[model samples]
Target: MASDYWDRYFRRARRMRTSRRRFLLGSATVGIGAAGLGLVGCGDDDEEEPTATSEPGETPDPTATSEPGETPDPTATARPEETPQPTATATEAPPDTSAVPTDGSYYSQVGEPFVGITLDIHRGVSGIAGGVEGSAYSGLIRFDDIPAPTFRGDLARHLPEQPDAVTYIFDLRDDVVWHDKAPTNGRPFTMDDVRWNLDRQLTRTLADGTVADDFTLTNTVFTHIDSLDYVNDETISFTLKQPRGTWLESLAFAGFMDQGVAEQIESDPDVISADRIVGTGGYMFTEFVPDGRRIAERHPNWHLRQAGEEVQYFDALALLDVGADVNAVRIALEQKQVDWIGGRFQRQAYAPEFMQAIQDANSDIERLDVPALNANRALIYSWEIGPFSNPMIRQAFYLALDRQLVLQQDFAGEGRITGPLPWAFTDWALSEEEILQQPGYALNKDDDLQEARQLWEAGGGEDLEDNIELVANEPDAVRLSEWFTAMMNGNLGTDKIEVKGIPGGSILPYLTGEDPIAFLTPVSAWTSPDPRQRLARSYTTAGSINFGKYSNPGMDDLFDQAAATLDRDEAISAMKDIQRLAMTESGAGTILMAAATGRFLKWPYLKMEFNPWRLPVDERSWIDQSDPTFSGRPSL
Candidate 1:
């Protein structure tokens, strides 16, 4: 089947030559239409990393989305009073729209919402569009779709062209539609909308000349672009200020914004919730009950189609925000009140007992226990301000962190140590053996600990204020933070650093504000396959979430060179240099931590073809109503 798809893909490439989006590009660069998609597996984390199944030189198998059945109003679909494990029943009725659609509904933990009036979707969390990283958004191309990282065009017609190191040309897709809602009213998505959105990301100022706060959350991705030009309504091009390795891949991070949304935000600023969402995604915002329930019904007139039929299988999608209680989430899954659970990067959210029950039941619940490589990241300090500004202190802290211990205890010893890029992106990230030899990652830490104390003493960190604050983005991280503190205090001094458990909602502001709290380890869900783009987003001086404001000109230059260099070896060398500079040598800003493999639970009814990052719940997902494991699902 994979061979047949690639055969068709190559044949299609041959046919598309000198026509439409495939025009004039090399055969290797041409993209297949929506009909063919390469199979991909993904990691559930705040940051994105590609997981390739291929061996050293073998081409991995490809998978395709089955044609979508067609896709309504969201009532919360309150959890039906769960019956005992032996049987299941629904006391309350499912809303009308949900019942009408045969495609299954998916449920997962969407962390708290961002509270500002503006939508900070660029930062991965929105005021209303809870974790809009890949959902509730559309970019020029579906460039970063995980597991495979194939360049399946979304808004743009196909893969783009780099006429030179600093220029990119693209042909726009003609069939595009905004969700049928107010402000947008099912308007055709056009080049004007593209310009409007990119302008905000490229510049800090809005149309009214007022400072754009959350709208500019992704400025770092576009810092290279000096200008953008619309070559008629069908085409567009970008002129970069300088050559950048991440220039092409970085576009995936820019989810297009609607003109109406901008105007609406500019006027009231307070109404930018999920209810105000006007996306080009298959799902449209239907209901949003703060901290409670949120849902999106399908767009009947969705533009992306296969064989003239809408592509999304689910008629409506519900994101259940049942808070931190593991037993409650487990019970919801056990009784079949919700279709799935244990995602949104909080792997620890699903209790071990729940997984044991699934395994012990001997039923095909369709679960995957995979490695979570990307989420294994460390906290960056406010280098521009306090104690962390000292490289000696930063290196000492990095050296003192016991990543292997954390992996063994908290993560159950499932994953491996990570550097700038996680282990998932096999194509580029440094090898584990190479990483183990680094200063802080050595197996024997006795020398490392002595060196850490010496560095701490030499840097005058011993004279600093007591209890340096360490903030974590979510609850699971609180434990990691505590462990870090204990390790540091035990290694350096009796009382050195303090742990602060910050809620996801307020952490962004805490990190991005005028006076950000000391240190933070955010769960950044970066889904791009390229390493340069990751560095551009979090490591660059203009990074969207360079919370600690750590900057290194040499590393920045290396990133640009890596992006612009076409030779794979040259690009990879530049990449390693960037990682070593930021993660190891100078600017010891980022501390690479351990990646934990986790188990994702889903009902057999959900025909999920691949391991989705955030369930990127898309057109491919359908329901197998007759699957035996779906036996006792609640009646509508």
Candidate 2:
């Protein structure tokens, strides 16, 4: 199933590459996924083939060679049969010094890498605002390496392991310290902090009858944790309600806060004001100008830094609020007003002309593009509401959409038409042939529309009000929503569809309400590499982010079984079943297109680590200026 999916995807990718050279050199840039540039392709033919399996207790190296047309299967990585106990140990392996030049002259010319970045702060910074989660904050565990999902100790000393499938123990580094800010006093990070943070999500109410404002609002991911025990200052344990195969992957969402800060917020929720939010990350929050800009300075006491090493490659980080206008963001990058721009700001790939302008404006700029995992544009229906309440109506709406036309007209043929699961889950995602086999996704628009018309007539026809509103938070979403509205009206002959472009803040209230029948939204499941994390959260009856409020007992059972199964192959099979149910059986939501490969425009002088899953480069990136021709000044 997996190999067949890749075969079709790469074949489509090769077709897009015909114009790649022209798109890159000319003023206009192509959207992501245009030429298989974002998708995985075959390697050299002479490379040795990798073993299909690894030794027990060892994960197969993701970098191993593969056949020309095949990519590494993430599921082939080893899974733990039994949970490993917490051990107070640290891997003291030094950073790969071989990558650095021995001359040290590059560091001298660069001075300090002061990178200025701009983002659409409309999502708001996490902890300070109510809506943002892991996307906006650095969690306890993060995907240290991309394409492989290899995790390294971030806040914790090492990755947590299950003693059994039901229990997980986290061994935190004793040296991790809180920022030298108020309330925290630069104290050593402790298990109490982890316990308090976890408890905020698991236990909503305190023994004293006060509410715990978990602040993060990711309690849905922790619903499986039956209880948490503060074993010691350096150890914390989580007892699950049931076995979960993706429990370790779920830890990536466990961003920690000081116990004192958490308790104070529980007492006075207002204590979590923008300026008061605290975390023990590489960067410390300095200032936030709402809807304008936010700033963070390098923390002098980051625990990850090696002895005698520079505290950080960059002295400070800036997050500018460029608003919802993509053109304004482009202008900012061209003028060198911001050193880099990516993340949600670059969610949609640009037109060829826009790309040309950026290249023409600055020769020093470089593009870093990668295919997004678990990120896609989707049409979300309000299952609990009026028109969408009828499954026939929902199915009719799905069939009415011409996905291929939308991909060409709006996306410039840069996106792949996908199902509920994002293309990021390459191993389990259904192939284009398989996706089209599902109702409404077929290539024959005439046949789909004819079926949709029949379904609509059968589902009360004219009695069902065709009048519906589609809301979008971002510019690209608005464009997609507008295109969909036209298609439904023109093709399906439903003239009552309306499109509304609203601020990101207003999205939740609109979707969770009874007014809007459906909305076009950009959804992502990149928090963890595990498919269960997304499957359970987006489809289950009690899913936290199930905005449409979709519910199904059978589907829930499938997700639960997938989560409980420890074997990789079995878990994958279960996840595939969940996708099949969601796409073929439930029809709860329609995935419009897989997320386009993201493009990051950076100055040549900026030296940064690239992670397709992460954007705008994090704090670990540095600036390099060994070349005599380049200067730190803005090129424009």
Candidate 3:
């Protein structure tokens, strides 16, 4: 049955490829598959061979779980005969609040413990706000004083696990509550809410009566939903049409919605009106000003601690939706308008002079580094349209680019031309040699004007005549775009290629599969250590994260086999094949750079864990006024 399904997918994939490139557009036409939104892709080369599999081995029996107290090797093929304790609840108990820190007594200087960031980077929240109306809010999960493992505790309810690529189970706790006294507050979170939200996307329709387009499914198996059933009110079970190894780790994505909030929205479709929130998280929503900010005070009832001991203190969390602009951030930070800021800010905008001023003024600041699973920034051209639609022209463009030169001149030698996967988190990411060994890898970056000319003539470029329009959003992107334009104009010869600049917001329209001609935006995600989630995200027809819309039958079949093989060795073998497939295309993507978050602080009790997707913050990372790190800072 699975083989038949795989064959059907391949048939469709071949059709998609007949066209040079397929343009993916907004939610209306966006198709993320059943696997949800996990990042996935293969290596940088175009011809890497798939991983080898074992000889006939009896498939593991599905009736038993792993033995408790024994950790299963992710790569081992011998399936365990026993079942571990079934996760009966997704929720854990709240921690004792008597030990928490008093707010006023702690020092306010920015540092690891008491860092402040100026967050002015905001995106307009119009149609994209989900259940939260026109209110624009950037998610923040920072807990300044406490560190990792501890921070992971306060957020026990939200974080799920990745035992394998396929199965994920969450059991709810009954003790958490909302800040407001609304009827919805403190009510046990049920499976109904989970199923409801998932179904909403599955069945989403436009105001015009068309099915709302889902964006994740172009190259993944993710559907808005496959099957969602509640074992009980406190436990929820999700069965995917495909096995997703990285689904659990993908939960770290900050924007993953909340159940209670969604249910409220479903009941009224305008539930965000309340200033208070009703989530079962460690913090209570104290205030929420649409498009401005939302504050979350630590739940005195949060359950978490250091090394099994209950946490000693907790602090409030704030969400500030500053337009995410660099100048705004500098002003906001200098004027003390905000505390911390994250997300892709232009590096040049944050010049040495600005950083020096903050540091010299005794500003409590520290930069952060979190690994993510994103492909390199690329000048993605749609091979289906214009000159790029021609394979030779596409190859000509590659020859025109001196990737090393671009890295040094455009990114200060801080970038790398990576394969499909980001390299920061993994030690064994595909190397240049590995990429070359692959079947479809770019053999070299050398310009072959002869080849370019020959292909140009063959494709009728000599008569049709095509020019490239480059697009970018922020200043850095603009700078990067211009650099590429200059290269194309200078190297591609006369009457061959002209490069023009388009604004950043316009890039999304292109990503939405709009005009056949346009520079695609830099797709980003933190890489997962394991390949299952990454592979699922890359190959599944439903995954939102597969932006290139590349699909292959052979790859899809291998992914399915990998996912179903409960044995670790078999799964890993399947994952390697998936990775090789992603790298082969070496599309318009480029891994420009990995970033670390900068923190300006004073307390030493802060610790953070890299979700690769985003930082996981909660009460566990904050220090109380009771801790010794609370020294006062001089007013600016």
In order, the Cα lDDT scores of the candidates are 0.56, 0.51, 0.37
- Which residue pairs does candidate 2 place in steric collision? 27-356, 28-352, 28-353, 28-356, 29-352, 83-162, 83-163, 157-173
Model 2 scores what on Cα lDDT?
Answer: 0.51
The TM-score obtained by model 2 is 0.67
Listed in order, each prediction's TM-score against the native is 0.69, 0.67, 0.59
Query: How high is the lDDT of residue 609 in model 2?
Result: 43
Candidate 1 has a TM-score of 0.69
lDDT of 3 by residue, 392-485 (tens): 6565555555555553443343334455544432333555567545432343534354555555567665565345555544444445545656
Position 393, candidate 3: lDDT: 59
lDDT of 2 by residue, 439-532 (tens): 7777878888988888877887467545666766554454555566788777666576677666655655665565744666445434333556
Residue lDDT tens for model 1, 238-299: 89887654445446546676766766666676554565667887778777655556777767
Task: Arrange candidates by TM-score, descending.
Answer: 1, 2, 3
Sorted on lDDT, highest at the top, how do the candidates line up? 1, 2, 3
**Candidate 3 Cα deviation (angstroms), residue 441:** 10
